[model samples]
Target: MKIAIIGAGAMGSLFGGRLALAGEEVWLLDVWEEHVRAINDKGLAIAAADRDIVARPKATTRLEDIGTAELVIVFVKSTATAKAAETALSLLGPDTAVLTLQNGYGNAEAIAAAVGAGRVIAGTTAQGATLLGPGRIMHGGSGETHIGELGGGLTARLEKIAACLTRAGIQTVADDNVASLIWGKLIVNVGINALTGITGLKNGELAEHDETRQVLALAVEEAVRVADAAGVKLPYGDPVEKVLAVAVATAQNRSSMLQDLSGGRMTEIEAINGALVREGERYGVATPVNRVLTLLIKALEKLPRENRP
Candidate 1:
């Protein structure tokens, strides 16, 4: 298969490296010149628990160099989804499938607008990865990925892609209720990401403290109400319970938002929690908790390096 990874960041490098190691014809496309040069010169280095891997996948900083791909996997931050999809249109073949494993809501819609809805696959993954440096990533943990067409039905294409991901060591499930799956991921992020970023706590530590737990509950509960009001039936029966469960499962991990905050990079606060606030307003649902978190995180982003918490 000819594959192109659009973002080529931490998760993008991890996914592209695994597929390249599995012998697929993969090309990693990114705007970061340093990372691209590093991968092209040496290789993508993945630091794992038991072993480290260096996979030589073709990489490019220029979009024109990417060529056409049968599959394009988008791992850009949610804020960059539209621009990434627009830029990636040059790499799509006539029958190319665009898969978005991005966080938060509305990414699929943005990609669909650029690449056509029929060819878009909306999905989420629990897999964790941290970028160690240019062309290097730490495989934080392994988890399941779920994907499906936006309109919701299983197709041969979806199944085939899931099988390929599984072969590359990512356990994947082809789901019909992909929207619910996406919402489930959003709930988890709403509960965990900002809380972790604010308190400088690991996922497990959020569960250990009463104050943090109350804050997490406030965020999750408000998000659940807003999601329900918007007609999104979350897959989990009790969304708060599900969020806490994921906190336990990935206890030692620092969230992507926290990572960005610590590195003085822009966090996806507008996409995750801010999206909730936006939807809550549209549906006339109260989401004060999410709104507060959104504001606090945005405030933190503006802090000077020496003053940041």
Candidate 2:
């Protein structure tokens, strides 16, 4: 399979390298010039669950560099979805399968609009990864990925993609209601991301203080209500409890939103809490905490880059 990953940041690089190592022809495409040069020069440096690297896979920033790909997996930030889609359109002919595994909400819809719903399969992955440096990615956590068609119904081709990911070490599951699965993941992220981001602390740090716990409760409560109204079933216990449990599980790890804030890059806030607020308003259901988090993150985004750290 000619697998291609767009946005070769942390998770993208990790998957690309592992697949190539597993004997899959993987191509990594990124917008960052330095990263492109780094991978082209020094094979992707993976240093977490397994060490060392694979150099056979090729990488580039130019869309042309990513010729025809049978399956294209998008891993770019949520905010850059449109741009990536516009650039990636050239890489698709008619039968290319395009999948998005980026965090947050509304990703599937955007990708579907870009490349027709019939060619899109959305997935949510629990496997955690972080960028250590140019071309270096640290895969720190173990998790499963659920893949399915966005608007329901599936085929032999979806099965083929799932089989390939499973053999490459990314535990996989195929579900028809992939939309609900993605929402479940979004609820968990909304519960944890901003609280950890604003406090400049790790996930476990939220449980250390009552105020953080309160914020978590407020966000999850409204998120659950919003999700329930939207007809989605979460995969765990109370949304808040599940997120706190995840916070405790990933205690030492910093939330990715916080990493973006610390790096002065735009976050996926709009797709998380921001998505909630927008939906709540559409349904005439208020989502105050989500609104506040969205505002705060936007405020943080407005700050001069040098001052963020």
Candidate 3:
């Protein structure tokens, strides 16, 4: 299969490297010149708990270099989805599948506007990765990946992509109700990401403290109510418990939001918590906790580097 990763960041590089190691023809496209040059020179170095290996995948800053690809996986920040989709036109063929495993809501809609709804696949992944440096990535954790058509149902194309990813060691499922999967993951993020981003605490620490745990429960409950009002069915039974379980499972990991804040980069608060606030208002559900978290993160975003919490 010919594959193209639209954003060659940590997650993008990890997926690209795994597919390349499985003998797929993969091209990593990114705007970062330094990262591209490093990968082209030394290959992609992947460090994990059980093993370390270098996978050779083509890397480039130019989209034309990749031409048309059979699969295009988008891993860019939610803020960049629109621009990335527009730029990805050069690599889209009629049969190409555009999969977005990015964080937050509305990504599928944004991509669909450019690539057409029929060609877009929306999904979520529990896999975690961090960029150690240029051309180097750490596979921090792994989990099931779910994908499906925007309109739902188990299509042949969805199963084919799932099979391809599974063959590359990424356990993927072609779910019939992918919206539940997306919303389930979003609720987990709503409970964990903002709190960790604000306190600079590790995932497990949120559950360790009573005060933080209570606050987390409140935020997750509000999100659940909003989801209920929106008529979205969550995959899990207890949203708060699910979030806590995930935090405990990934105890040592620092969330993407925390990593962004610490590095003085913009966080995805708008897409996560802010999206919840908007949905809550639209559905006439109150989401005070999520609203507050959204404002706090936005305020943090505007602070000077030295002034940020």
lDDT of 2 by residue, 240-289 (tens): 88778777766766778988988889889989899989888877788988
In the range 1-309, model 3's lDDT, one tens digit per residue, is 999999998889999999999999999999999999999999999998889999999999998898999999999999999998997788888899999999898899999999899888999887778788999998877778889898889999999999999999999989888778788888989999999988889888899999999999999999999999989999889889989988887676678887788778999998999999999999999999999999888878887777654
CA deviation > 4 Å runs, candidate 2: 49-56, 207-210
Per-residue lDDT of model 1, residues 87-118, tens digit only:
77898888899999988889999999998999
Best model per TM-score: 3
TM-score attained by model 1: 0.95
Candidate 3: how large is its RMSD? 1.4
Task: Please say which candidate is ahead in TM-score: 2 or 3.
Answer: 3
Which scores greater on TM-score, model 1 or model 3? 3
Question: Best lDDT goes to which candidate?
Answer: 3
lDDT of candidate 2 at residue 136, scale 0 to 100? 75
137, model 1: CA deviation in Å? 1.1
Ten residues in sequence with the least summed lDDT for candidate 3: 300-309
Which regions of candidate 3 fall more than 4 Å away from where they truly are?
A: 307-309
